[model samples]
Target: MSAQDIARMDTGEIVEYEPVTPMELEFMIRELGARLENAVPVLKELWAARYSAERALIEEKAKAVLRSDARTITEKRAEADLATMTFRRDFDAAKETLHAAEELQKALASRLMGLQNINKVLGHAYGASR
Candidate 1:
């Protein structure tokens, strides 16, 4: 599946990784790395949005304090602000996506290493026979 297809996988869906030949593994690694690099900007934007959410919450509290709003009202407003920070959901989703990409990258590396080690062992066995 393409990277975008992977991204679109539903939570209830389970997809197994099919083993690739060593040559294909190298290309997959490069593709995954590029996807990760491309995601940097999106990650940055998500973080910026999260920070802005924090700032907005802080400003609301500060304004309430300045206006001498009732303590109960201020607390309730904070709770509401937290509940409505929709960007938090987006940011968390983006974070999870990046994490998944990293994990796939690691898996690709591990697969490549295992194949290389197997090749080396076979080479040694053949050399010994010669």
Candidate 2:
């Protein structure tokens, strides 16, 4: 009997067991065994499908993490590039200033040498006249 039928039966008195032939008992056992055997492949397929879906989800999550890391790396590289460019510009300006200072120093040294030569010539001329 089906579980629903058994549940709907009155609970006033215990039911008496009905006797069946040995052949009928054997047939029922074989039928139930066959039904269980038929269900095994279906259950296996369902389990495999569930496993595949879980693996796909894990792979997708990994891909998303990798994409995020790539974006972060790109941004960091851009920042580093900008910092390097700024440093190069400052270095170039400082180099130009240093060059200008060196040129001024050379000009001052030449002027001082010319003044000294003029002073020596005047001293010799005054000594000769005295």
Candidate 3:
């Protein structure tokens, strides 16, 4: 069964029984392909446009959190350094802070990677559909 036949076969009966013309088949394929191709950009645009408000709010929250974290990390690092300066007694505290920072860095990196994967999937869907 051709692409067009499947498409028109809603009730398991071929409606266009006049022998599927080449032009008809091609037209159906192209039309469906175009629709699929256009869907990706449309979806992306929708995602971007729809997320504007939520994204803005998230951004504001993220900025505030980031600022707070920056201050905290700085203070912790300084404290760690000072403690280390006095003696090696505070080595554990300093190491813990460094480890926390590393964990946070890893989380952010993973988030970025996830976004990249989403974009790649969108691209692939767009291409395949087209």
Candidate 4:
């Protein structure tokens, strides 16, 4: 079979092939680490932007309620109450998302650290074997 066909085989499928070289593994780790490092900051910035937008929306809605005509006070109050509830719900959801992203970032950091340790150990083993 061609090398491409062999590479495409599923894990359980029998196919004779060499394992990934130490250099190839190191390169993959480095690439993944770089991508993860870049992603965390961008994710944090996006979360902050979303939070700011939501807060501004809530403030604008509050001002609108205050400026509404007295003739429609009852209707305006009801609308304001609904808007407040909706805003609270959205804010809560955003907070949850931010927490989730933070947790993911922590996990990624831990994984990256683990990969660095593995790379060091592998480098030592490869050098000793040579």
Per-model lDDT: 0.55, 0.45, 0.46, 0.63
Candidate 4 residue spans exceeding 4 A from truth = 1-21, 57-82
lDDT of model 4, residue 48: 88
Instruction: Pull out the clashing pairs in model 3.
Output: none
Please name the candidate that would achieve the greatest lDDT relative to the true structure. Answer: 4
What global local distance difference test value does model 4 have? 0.63
- Clash pairs detected, candidate 2: none
lDDT of 1 at 83: 58
Q: How close is candidate 3 to the true structure, as a TM-score?
A: 0.31
Cα miss at 7, model 1 (Å)? 5.2
Estimate, for each residue in 24-113, the C-alpha lDDT of model 4 and write its tens digit: 556545654665677677777868866886886679677768976656878777777666776767777777767666665566566556
Write one digit per residue (lDDT tens) for candidate 3, span 1-130. 4545423423322233222344543444454455445545644554454455445444554444554534576665554444334233333444444454444335434443544455566567769999
- Which residue runs of candidate 3 sit more than 4 Å off their true CA positions? 1-89
Worst 10 residues of 2 by lDDT: 5-14
TM-score of each: 0.50, 0.37, 0.31, 0.57
